[model samples]
Target: MSIPTQPTDPAATIPAVGRINWRAARAMLISEGRLLARNPGVVLWTVVLPVAAAIILGSIPAVRRPSAGLGGLSFFQLYQPILVFFAITLLAMQALPDVLTRYREMGVLKRLRTTPVSPTLLLFAQLTLILSVAIVCMALMVVIPPLGGAPWPRNPGGFVITYLLGAWAMLGLGMVIASLFHNAKVAAGFGSFLFFVMQFFAGLWWQRPNMPVWLRDISDYTPSGAAVQGLTDSSIGHWPRALHLIVLAVWGAATSRLAIRFFSWE
Candidate 1:
């Protein structure tokens, strides 16, 4: 066979800068964000459901009426952040698994594999979407409750730190679940079970002090329990929010490493 001459155009001979790895990463982030934003179920779970839960929970006659020791802060105020945590927990648990599995099933992951970007970049992009949405939800939870008669965080710094730690913990837990589950559906079911278990035993619907001493102590060690305690303490003096933050950070780091290590592209 006769050899053919090379193309004269450098553009045809070499890949453009736009085709580089960083560029591919940016594109992946944008694509992943758009896709997550477009998912109706995700939209409902992340945005609408939390607000709905807060509203419904706050409407209960007992919750609307304040009792002793419970800050005049309505149930909405107390529950809003918890609801935000719930939303983050739900979204984080299912988002990665669902997106990864769907893309793998659709050949998207296979095509992405041929690109300059690593599969890890795509996964991070999805995580970024979930976390970004979570921050927005936190903002809404913080802002709306104050408008509805909830007291502002007396120690805004503590509130911010504690909430962020809680968010990280929730994200870590979700990533762990996603890593374990092969499909979005399984992750979703598992997430629901985890949420109910955590919320019920923690202080989501009521006060932890009401529980037995042993249960209270155990609950204090849980991420959800720490979050509620840290948040509640924001109204009075800043308590040892450090413990919650530390526990959450440790869990987050460990689980995040495991998630990355066990993450599957197939």
Candidate 2:
């Protein structure tokens, strides 16, 4: 007796076979942009808070203790980058979790599942939104502060380098948070908690190098710490800027890999 073989359908046989529809992706992006623009709370947290924090925090006589030739720089100049950092951090963490939860609840992801939308592409879309916000926030951070007489960056190249690296590092961190938590509440809570904790180590409250030995050691390894170092190095050249770059890149890569592996559409 001879054994029989079954034929396969080329499309059905490939489990992960689908190219993204750019039109669909573009539609998704437009929808996301509209949603972001319409949400008052999102606007408050993403835009208003950072500006308030920078000015409010910088205004505090205590917080204005200057270093790194900061005496020569105006108060707004010292705090401008910090404001952009806070805004980027805030937006990146909130974007994915809120969007994913709403999508899952609304059947957006489910409907998309039937199409050629890859998980990676969806992730990329979220990143693009965050990047847009970060860029805008950064522009505001750079431009608006100057209106208040903030000092211009002495080294524009260094400033650009720091902001780009730091933003991506936070973006990756946000993705990891979104992947780990299933519901919007859990994701939001975790993201918020981690944001505060990271901000502490990111030199928001105090310089990382001045922290206790154990804390300093931990800060050296965390994404926010690396980001703080990178941003600070843009003005004050203590460590080789390359080391901070490497740290941010490593965090971005590791967290992103973990996020992709554990991410769930549901």
Candidate 3:
């Protein structure tokens, strides 16, 4: 009878969805960066390999000779873009996926989910670290070549645009690999296989101009190939073909969506 009614707390009616914990994200990013710096394998792949390849190749007299097929640019000059793409590919296909897979396998991601920080923040942090490394590697690739007498890209803006697009495409591919594989070893093995295949198609081992017509046509649609072509075109003062940009954009968008839809956080 006329028992009682309790006052409700207005705050209780609302979900406690807080803003992103930037402090936590920043700390994780710093920790990840330090860990990455200590990993020699990552250093070799993302830094040493690309820079070494560029320097060693640039030193070759034959590579310094201008070729008609390359629009009067030497193989060394054309290879600058290839080296930049190589750095992106290494980070995306090998380092990033392996690290993410390891985190999931070791339950790091699971622990992260229980914290104030979202586990996705860790993923973003890893990507940011890897991208920072990629940028530094690419910068070295660009700056070192001129010391070897190679010309800089003719259209700096186009070159930068193409580089960014290519990096995004490759990183998206890496995210897909990270999402699909629960085992770090399996991810590393598959990532390595894909890395080598992409390198081949990107003209790391064989000149694109020397590839068979059909093979070249197919390679043009691949992320690495499109990236190389885009960079090379911009290096020579021409905007990349629409096909190159379209291929990179499609790869980036499709792979990123798939990764987001299916990503596992332990």
lDDT ranking from best to worst? 3, 1, 2
> How many pairs collide in each candidate, listed in order?
0, 0, 0
Query: Tens digit of lDDT per residue, candidate 3, span 18-90?
Result: 7777888899898988887787676574678778888777667788788998657788767878888988898
Error of 3 at 157 (Å): 0.8
TM-score of every candidate relative to the true structure: 0.80, 0.80, 0.90
How much is 94 displaced in model 2, in angstroms?
Answer: 2.5
Q: Best-fitting candidate, measured by lDDT?
A: 3
lDDT of 1 at 130: 76
Q: Quote the positional error of residue 169 for candidate 2 in Å.
A: 1.7
Candidate 3: which stretches are off by over 4 Å?
1-18, 59-62, 69-72
lDDT per residue (tens digit) for residues 31-105 in model 1: 877776576575565567776666556445566555555545555446655676676766665655566666655
C-alpha lDDT of all candidate models, in order: 0.69, 0.69, 0.87
Error of 1 at 120 (Å): 1.3
State the lDDT of candidate 2 residue by residue for 1-266, as single tens digits.
87767556666655554655788789878877777678657646677778666645544554444555443433444455556677888876776666666666676666777766754566677689778777877776566544544444556677777778778788878888877887878888887888788778776776554578798668867767766656655644334267678887888888878877887777
